[model samples]
Target: MGLFTDAYDLFCIPPIMRLIGRVYYGDVDDPKKRYQVPIAITSAMVAIALLGAVIGQLVFGHLGDRMGRRRVLAWCGNWRDYPLSATIMSEFANRRTRGGFIAAVFSMQGFGILASSTVTMAICAIFDAASHSSYEKTPKDADWAWRLILLIGSIPAGLTFYWRMKMPETARYTALVEHNVLQAVNDVRNVLDLPLRNEELPPYPSPLDYPFFSRAFFRRHGRDLFSSAISWFLVDVVFYSTTLVLSQLNDQYLPKKENMNAYQDAYNVARFQALLAICSTIPGYFATVLFIDHIGRVKIQIMGFFFMAIALFAMGIPYFSYWYDHSDRGFLFLYGFTFFFSNFGPNTTTFIVPAELFPARFRSTCHGISGAFGKIGAIVGSIGFYWASQQNEENDHSNAKRITAGLVILGGACIVGVIMTRLFTHETMGRSLDDNENDHVA
Candidate 1:
C-alpha cells in the first residue's frame, strides 16, 4: 500500500493538470500562459514532491539502519516505501527465488499506476455526471474536483500505517545492526514458522565495527554504492523525462481535442493514460516478476537498456516521416516496448540490486542514496524535456527535431546504463543475503 500510494500520487498529477489549469490558473491556451502551466505544475506539484522524496529517502534510510527497519520504516508515519520493503524482503527471501520475490513486491507499482489512471478516469466521470454538464472549456466551476482527487490519495496511506506499526523487524537487522543474534534467530523463527536451530554461533560483532563512512566501509562496499546510485540516476533521467514529454510524442498520433470541454478533454487524456497502464505498463512489471530470477538482474537490465535505446531511437528518428503518420501504430509499438522494457528491466533491477548488494549496516542507506539519485534524474528529465520543447516552439524548429533530440538523449542515457551494468554492477540472482554481505566484511 505504501508503494501503491507512491505510484498513485506520482501518476495522478499529469491527468489532473488540465483541471488545475482551468480551475486554479488562467488562460493556459494563451501563448504567454502555455509554458507557465507545465513548469508551474511540474515544480509546485510534481518536482517538489520528488524533492521531498529525496530528502525523505536519505533521512529514513539512515534511521532505518540506526533504529531498525520496522522502527524507522514507519515513515509515510517515518521512510519512503522502496528501501524498507526491499530490505525486509531481501533479508527474508530464499536464495533461489529472491529476485522474483522482490520483483513481485515491486510489481504492485504497476497496479498502483493502473489504480491512479482508473481513479482519475472515474473521478472525471463522476464530476461530469454530477454537474450534468460537459466540463467547461475554460473551467471555473469544478475547482473542487482536483482537490477531492488529491485528498483521496491519503486514504490508502493512512490505512497502511497501522499495519506498518504492527510489522516485525527483520532478523538480519536485529542480528547484524543491533548485535542480538539470539533475538534475530527468534524473529526469524517466528517469521518462517519454524523451530529454532540449536547450533551455537560465534559472538556478535560490535555495531561499532561497521560504522558507515569509515575506512573499512569504503574499501568493502564503495564500488557497489557508486554503481547503484549512478546507474539509478541514469535510468530515472530518461524515465522521468520521457514520461513528462510523452504527450508531445503522442500528440502526433492522437488528434488534439479541440472544441472539447474540459471534462471531455481530461477524460480522454486520463483514459489514454489508463490504457497505456493496462496494456503495457502493468504487464511489463509482471514480466519482471516472472523472469527476473531466471534471466538474472544484469541480463534483464542490459536487455531493457538496449531495447529502450532502440525504441527511443525509432520514435525520435522517425518523428518527421513514418512516426508522424496520421493513422500508423508503428510509433506506439515502439513506444509501448520502451515502457515494457523499462519496468521489466532497469526499473525493477536497480531497486532490487541496491537492497541486496550491500551489507545490512549500510543496506537501507545505500538504497536510499540510489533512490535519491534517481529522483535527481527525474527532475532533470522533466525540466529538460519541457525546456527543450518550449525552445523548439519559440525558435520555430520542427517538433520532430525536438522529439528526436529528446528521445535520442534518453537513448544515450540507456546506453550509459548498459555500460554501468556491465562494468560495475554485480548480479544478485540466486545468492543468499548472507553471501552478499560477506563480500563487504573484508
Candidate 2:
C-alpha cells in the first residue's frame, strides 16, 4: 500500500510536468529551443523532489535504525517510502520466499503507475471534451487539470496512513535490533496469527552501541554496501530519467503548433504514459515479482542491465531513420523491452537487495544510503538527458544527434551497472537477513 502510493505520486510527475511546462513555459514558437526546461532551473523544479528523497532517505534511514523500523516506517506522502517500505517488507518476509515477497510488495509501484496514468488519461479525456465547450484550450485551463491529478495522488496516501500504523513491528527487528525476545515472539505470533514459544535473546554486541558508518561497519559490510549504493544510483539514473523524459519528448509525435492545442498536447502525453504503463512497465514488474526468487536477484539484475544497454543502442544507432519513418512501432517495441527488463531486473533487485543485505539494525539506514545514491544518479540523468535531447537545434541532424546521444550515454550507464552487480552483489534468493549480514563479515 505504501509502495502503491509512492508509485502513484512518483509517476504522476511525467504527465503533470507536461501540463506544468505548458502552463509556466508556455508554447515556444521555436521548436529549436535550447532546452525543454530552463537548464539552470530544471534541477530545482523537476529534480528537487529527488534531492528531497536523498535527504529523506538519510534522515529516515538513520531514524529507522535508531528508533526501530516500526516507528520510522513511512506510510504516506513521504518520499522516504522508498527505503522505509523496503525495510519493513524485508524484515517481515522469511527466507523461503523473501525475494519474491519483497518484489511483490514493490510491484505495487506498477499498479500505482497504472492508477496514475489511468486517472490522468480519464481526466485528460474530460478536459479535452470540455475544451470544445469552453473554448478554453490554453495553458491557464491545463493548470487546474494537473493540480487535480496531484490532489488525486494524495488521496490514497491519506487513506492508508491509519491502517499502515496498525501493522505490528516485525519479529526480526524486535529480536535482532531491540534484543527483546519475548516481544519479538509476541509480534511474530500476532503478525502470523499463530502461537509461538517465546525464546531467549542471544548474547551479542548491541547494535545500539555501534554506529553504522563506523570502522566496524567498514570491516563487515562496506563492500556490499558500496555495491548496493552504486547499483541503485545507476539504475535510477536510467529508470527515472527514462520515464520522466519519455513524455517530455512527445513533441516529435505531436502535430505542429498550428494544429495542436495545450489540451491536445496534454491528452497525447497522458495517453502515451498510460499505454507505456499498461502494456510494458506493469508487465515488467509482475515478471520480477514472479521470478526474482527463482532466477536469483543478482543474475536477474546483471541480465537486465545488459539487455537494457542493448536495447538503448538498438534504438539510438538508427535515430534518423526511426524519426523520419515514424519508427514508433518498432521503437516502442525496443523501448518496451528496456522497460520490461528494467523492472524484471535491477530496478526490483536494487530495492530488494539492500533491504536484505544489512542486519535489521542497519537495514533502513543502509537502504536509505543506497537509495539516496540512486537519486543522485536520477538527478544527473534527468538534467543530462534533457540537455542531450536538445543539441544542435537548428541543424538537420539535431533531433537525431540528441536522441542518439542520450541513449548511448544511458546504455553505457547500464553496462557499468552490470559490472557492479557482478562484483558486489551476493545471491540472496533463499538466505535470511541474518545470513546475509554474516556473509559480509571477514
Candidate 3:
C-alpha cells in the first residue's frame, strides 16, 4: 500500500502545483490583480477532501475501536493502495527517506507523470505558438491534455478495486472481535513465531470491551482532538503561507524569462532550489524516526515550534526591507531560511504528532479534523498572500506589511501549540497498536 500510494503521490504534487500556476495565476503574461483567490479556492478544495476523510475517520475509527486496530489498518492499507492512495502517500512520505524505497516506488508515478507532462508541455508549446500567431487564436489544447492525463492515471486505480474487495480482514482484528480464544491463540503464535505457553491469554477480555466513548469518554477525546486540530490550524496557516509565498518570492527574484539566456541556467537554478528542499526534509524525518522513541513526541514538537519562532522573528526584519530594496540575492537568503525551518520543524511535526497522540480508535478522525483545519489555514494564507502581494505590487512605498505580519502571527500560534502539546498530547513512540486495548477500559 505504501509503495503504491507513494508512486501516485510523488508525481501528483508537482503537477498539481504546476496546475495551480496555470489555473489560478495563469501565464505570467496575464498576471491578475490578486493571486490570492486561486490559492484560497484550491486550499478550500483540500479542506473538502478532508471532509470525506473525516467521515471515513469517524466511521472507521468507531469500527476500529469497537472491532480492533487490525481491521482499520487493513482498510487503511487497501484504501491507501487504491483510489485514496496518492494523497495519503504524499502526506505520509513527506517525512522520511525509506532508503531507495520511496524513490523506487515513485518511479512508476514519475514515469506516468513524465509521459503526461510531456504531452501537456507539448500542448502548452503549441498554445504558446498559436497565441503569437497573426490570427490571435484562443487555445483549448492544454485543458483537454490535462483531462486525458487524469483519465489515463485513474485507470490503474480503478482496476485495483477488484483485488481490494476480496482481501481478508486482518488476523489481529479477527482475533479480537470474534472473541475466539483458539483462533486468537493461533494467530498470535503464527505472527510472533512463538509457541503459546498460556491458554488463558485470549479470553482475558470480552468483545464488549469496546465502544469506549460516552459523555465522559468523549470529553477527554474532544479535548485532545480540539487541541490537535487547533495546533495544526496554526501550523498549516504559517507553513503553507510561507511556502506558497516563497514560491512567489522565487519567481520574482529568479525571473524565469530574464534568467532564460541559456537552457542550463534555467535547469541549474531550479535544481539548486530543489536541492534546498530535499536537504530540508532529511533532518526532520530523521529526527522523527530516530529520537521519537527516546526524545519524545511533545518535546520534539516544542523544540520544532521554538525553532520556527526564532526563525520567523529574525526573518521578518530583512524580509520587509529586502523586498523594498529589490535585493534579489538578499531575499534568496531569507527564502532559504524559510524553507529550512518549514520542513525541519513545524511542517513535518504537524503531520506526525496527530498520528501519534490520538488513539487508534479515533486516530483517523482526529487526523481528518487536523487536516481540515490545516486546509482552512491554507485558505487564509492563500487569500492573505494575494492581498499582501497585490498591495506590494501596487503601492510600492508601504508595500503591505501583511506577509511580515503573518510570520509573527505564526510564531504566536507556535507558542500556543507548545502549550497544547504539553497539556493534551501523548508520547506514542514504539508502542504497539494493540497496547491501547487496556487503556482505561474498566
TM-score of each: 0.93, 0.91, 0.67
How displaced is residue 243 in candidate 1, in Å? 1.6
- Candidate 3 lDDT (Cα, whole model)? 0.49
lDDT tens per residue, model 1, 1-442: 7778888887777767867665655555665454135564555565787788889888787777878888876654322767888888888888888888888888777777788878877887787767765535655545777777778888888888888888878877888888788887777777778787835433444444657868887787888899999888988888887776686456545445455555666677677777888888888898998898888999999998889999988887767566655447877787788889999899888989999898888898889888989888888887778777666455434755776778888999999999999999988888877776665555
What number of backbone clashes does candidate 3 have, counting pairs of residues 3 or more apart or in separate chains?
A: 0
Candidate 2 stretches greater than 4 Å from native: 25-40, 74-78, 134-136, 200-210, 254-257, 321-328, 437-442
Per-residue CA lDDT of model 2 for 154-223, tens digit only, reads: 7778777876678787777777777787888788778878767764433333344457758877777798
RMSD of 1: 2.5
lDDT of each: 0.77, 0.77, 0.49
In model 3, where is the ten-residue run with the lowest total lDDT?
82-91
Counting clashing residue pairs in each candidate, in order, gives 3, 1, 0
Q: Kindly report which residue stretches of model 3 are placed more than 4 angstroms away from their true locations once superposed.
A: 1-172, 177-213, 257-273, 323-346, 349-363, 384-388, 397-400, 430-435
